[model samples]
Target: MDQYSVPAGPAAGEFRDRSSKFVAALYHVQDEAAALDAVAEQARIHNRCNHHCYAYRLGPGPDRWRANDDGEPSGTAGKPILGQIDKAGLSDILIVVSRYFGGTKLGTSGLINAYREAARLALEEVTVTQQLLLTGVRLAFGYALMTPVMSALSQLGLEMADQAFGERAEVLLELPESTASATVRELQAAIAGVYVEEVGDDFEVEGLTVLVTPTGD
Candidate 1:
């Protein structure tokens, strides 16, 4: 897919029932690693919480998702949170709900409702934005081709993720997937002595600490 909806930034929501407190945290994640990092971060922040239930969906695939009840009833916490994420039609997102038991038992139905409502509330506070899918490329060339390669990148409005100047110069790039092949062909045809190869699917804008919404196509 060219683009998909993701949270604009971090958001939080709270729910209280029978004196029990549920805190939900929402984050934009790029992959499973990022999702797990978010989960760990939440756990650390709520270290005293009774349980830290979480759910995450990555990419556009149906199978790229996970849910964890984290001590609540098997289906009570994690499933409800995931349901809210699916209902929102979002990807590259994670939701973690930390529960502080109030000494009163909410039972199965009550627990489910609380988690669902907490997740929904957190999502409601989020501003959704489109995340552009990009393909990664690595370029290898002699020092003589550096000037032309940089010029080509500038002309094509492409961003370089990294550059190394060793015996042979190397540059990393992020390109829109739809035009990645054409871009490679154009670069090779225009700049001889340069080798271009696709590295992977994931890409990040250089110097960006947070997920960015690329403007235009």
Candidate 2:
């Protein structure tokens, strides 16, 4: 998948059933590690709560994800939270629902509805945004080819993440995955003596490190 939906930022939701309070907190996370960290932090914040259930989806396909029921019954908390996330077609996000029991027990269906509703409410409060998968590219070329290389990238509507000027010129680019290959080919055809290679998004260009952020089209 080239793009997917995610929460623009953090949001909170609340649900009450039979005096029990369910607080849902949503966060935008890039990977599983961040997602887990969010969950852990929520647990610490709501240390008095009885349960800290959570669900997270990551990446384009979002196949790498998990749901935790915490101390709640199997599938009572986590599954419903995950269901709400999938219903919204969202990824790279985490939702944790902390429950404060009020001397009452909610059955299986009651737990599911409470969790689902909490998650839904949290999602409703968030502004959904799209995340585009991008490919990082490093270009090295001679001074003579700098103008053409830069002009080619500009014509393609691509922006440089980082650039360095020395004996040779080096530039870092983050291209949309859909057009990365085509953009590279166009640059090669337009400029001579230019070296181009695909790199990971985290790859840093020494001497001139710049942050490359993914933007939706």
Residues 19-126 of candidate 2: C-alpha lDDT, one tens digit per residue: 999999999998888998999899999999979999998878747789999989999999999999999888889999999998888899999999999999999999
- Looking at model 1, the pairs that clash are none
lDDT of 1 by residue, 162-187 (tens): 78788877787777767766676655
Q: Indicate which candidate wins on lDDT.
A: 2
Residue 108 in model 2: lDDT: 96
Q: What's the C-alpha lDDT at position 10 in model 2?
A: 98
lDDT of 1 at 87: 98
Q: In model 2, where do residues sit more than 4 Å from their true spots? A: 154-157, 193-217
Model 2 is weakest, by summed lDDT over 10 consecutive residues, at 203-212
User: How high is the CA lDDT of each candidate model?
Assistant: 0.82, 0.82
